[model samples]
Target: MMGQFDKNALPVAIIGGGPVGLAAAAHLIKKGEKFIVLEAGESVGSSILEWGHVQMFSPWQYNIDQAAKELLENAGWTSPDEEALPTGRELVEKYLLPLSNLPEIKEQIMLQAKVVRVAKKAHDKLKTGKRDTVPFQLYVEANGDTTVIEAKAVIDSSGTWTNPNPMLSNGIWTNAERQLHNEIHYGIPNVVQLENRYQNKTTLVIGSGHSAINALLGLATLQQKYSDTKIYWVLRKKQIHEVYGGQENDGLAARGELGIRIQQLVESGRINILTPFHINGVYPTNDKITVVGELNGEEFTIGDIDEMVVSTGFRPDTSFLNEVRINLDSTVESIDTLAPLIDPNTLLG
Candidate 1:
């Protein structure tokens, strides 16, 4: 049960400065709500900065909310073309920064301010019987100084790009090997190090989703440049084309081009594609890592691999909200009860 508070005196605090958080800020501004946005990174759109080379499949039209669009237009902000799919950097530069710059929104932001803990405040009420505004102690570290903020609400629009899912490989790849070559698992874009790692060596990429496709295409591109890298793709699915079509087609040509390239690779024998194979375990050998797997009820071992990249999806970061007791789904995604979940809404807890 939430404790009663004097509604009029509370200020809202938004956690995260991503696109969703920015949209929430715009909404709060229109509603004449007092709020502050806290971003853990040095600037707004930190997630986009991490995905510099990746382009969103959603077009500019789908990308911008009506409130954001109207605010930008009224402020004489030039919008990107609806047909162009902006790269992560472009999206940050063209849309996020400008939207945040609006007088109503920019003043409410506290950049490089990470919220470490969110706890409830206990206080006495005045003669009105309403508790003095509940203060959510937001531990913010900015410019070498730490401060606490008391806010009426909290909104969490932090996207899932911060955490990358781990690749589940058995003992085939020893812990020591993984520690030694950690760069293979890092999601750095436009990198071409596969040739150096897999020249005349067999490489296996796990997962059948977009990340797998990305790895295959990236390795293919590297092979084209180096002319000596051998790559193999392993998936639990029966066929590669079966995983092709989805909602990826919006404005970016790279997604569709990647699908086409994947098909071509399978047809041209450049990539050895394996499907319906379950990875049972892995053990490191003298010459190569032994990958034990069951293919159609028969178990076999694949050895001599240079690297494996897992492109599994990510989960939202909501562990900080556990104490606040906000209603969350089984997957831990905040339930959209009313307004945004992280910033101002946290005050309700």
Candidate 2:
């Protein structure tokens, strides 16, 4: 069911059916442009659903895209409470799901379709001849079948949830760590739902970002119910306060409250804090995990009896864009020019 689009003109290709991808579609529709959305997941916002139990710090007012809001409003969709914060599940259910079901957007989205490669239509990366005239070619796989789709333009909104950073400080993925797949968990696990796995168990949480804080906080809650639950917090920063952000001074009250809450938990001494710890390796021994690292210029080894949560954050998977000749920064792994603008170090400096 093609919209009022020219049959001869190639449609714009939008990758990832998450909020950013869908928002791009909404804007394209407003411009009377043809587009197709290719999502690798089974449904829209599939990555967000992984941490569905966790609440977002931002209110509904900032979460909704203006173009998407216009489209949904025109379709008779009722807006959620503007000032209220929503969980990841609520964002997907109340907002993303509704936007994806719109007639104009629904017909264009392809789910469970992974994009393996993207390149110029008739030219390789090295070939400059007629490159400007050629449309982009995408190799997408779905249901064990590979197909080529051509588009006038491509918008890569495929976020970083699928590609997480390694636990090792050097950013290396070792077999020893890979072998403990069952014991190690990445991102935030729903502690309440998976109580059996974490209850009365020793858990190590690595990293100092919001994701790690959220993971620790969840375990802390679980620890209250089962007094034996042990939690270890590891950070590369010399001072744990470095990760607390602006606290009360922050513009967003909800976000600032996270810093306040985590600080209080630290003061309570429920969690064992390891600062300036650089993990060198992880080993599984006797059905338990052992983490070897350097803590404050001294060798340290922490042997655990249970689960491990690595909240080291995520990176964008840009392998499919290899042949597209896009420039990215090695440090930030983002568009070279834009990396400096968004880099935290730069912003703080």
Candidate 3:
């Protein structure tokens, strides 16, 4: 089918099939440009499905891209209310599924296709002449088979879902932490459905973001039914009140309610909150997991944790992009051009 198009013309490549990647495809289609979307998962929005049970803080208006909205509207699809927030599942099923089904997009997207490497065709990093004209060579692996795709340009909206940051405050990956991967879960798990697993067990929840709050709240709910279960909320933040975000003054009701709910749980003495804890390491100690850290410039250790829920957030994976020449911030991992705009103080606000 690709042979039908001009052999001299290469399709632009978009490296993810999530909302941003799909939106890029729509815009490319509007401009009458050829493009292909490569998705690493089994289907579109596969990453979003991981948190499908959680409702988004933002409503549909801010979530949907303009190009995608137009594409769906042109297909006679009536969208959900702009003010109504949807869960991750609803976003995928009601939006991404329909967008992927569009002939313009469906035929161009490759599911279960993981991009392993990207580089300029017929040239190494050292070579320079005519490099701009050379198409990008993307090596994609699917079912153990590798295929090379030539793209005129690459729009990498691959995202950062797969690469979660560690709970260690020093920001280092230790050997001890590597062995505990099975015992620790990075994102929010369906705590409600895991009552049997967490019932009467002591679980530690890390990070002060909404992710941490959700995990703590879920475990607290579990504790209500099973009083033996204990929930610990740990963070490196100096002040616990900072995580509350905007309460009644917030525009988004759902986001504000999360802080309010978690604050109430903490005030009720349902959650054992720990802050300013600098995680030193996590390792096995006599068939039990031990979390060693620091608090108030003093050494501290917490043990007997049955399970750990880490909401430490994720970083963008640029391992494959090493071959591709692009400017990326050393710290935040965002595009170098936009990295300056990020301020940790105002970010949570």
> What is candidate 2's lDDT per residue for 262-288, written digit by digit as tens?
999999999999999999999997878
What is the lDDT, from 0 to 100, of the residue 124 in candidate 2? 88
Deviation in angstroms for 164 in model 3? Answer: 0.3
Off by over 4 Å in 1: 1-5, 122-133, 144-146, 169-181, 186-188, 192-203, 246-257, 279-302, 331-349
TM-score of each predicted structure versus truth: 0.78, 0.96, 0.95
Tens digit per residue, CA lDDT, model 3, 1-349: 1123343488999999999999999999899999999999998999999999888999999988888889999999989999999999999999999999999999999999999999987678778866777788999998899999988899988888888989898778888788888778899988998788789998899998888888888888889999999988889888888888898877899999998998898889987877888898998888678898887668988999988998998888889988878887776879977776774544654
Where does candidate 3 clash, by residue pair?
none
List the candidate 3 regions with Cα displacement exceeding 4 Å: 1-8, 345-349
lDDT to native, each model: 0.71, 0.92, 0.88
Q: Compose the digit string of candidate 1's lDDT tens values, residues 253-293.
A: 65666666677777889887767677776556665566677
In terms of lDDT, the best-performing candidate is 2
Angstrom error of the Cα, residue 158, model 1: value is: 1.6
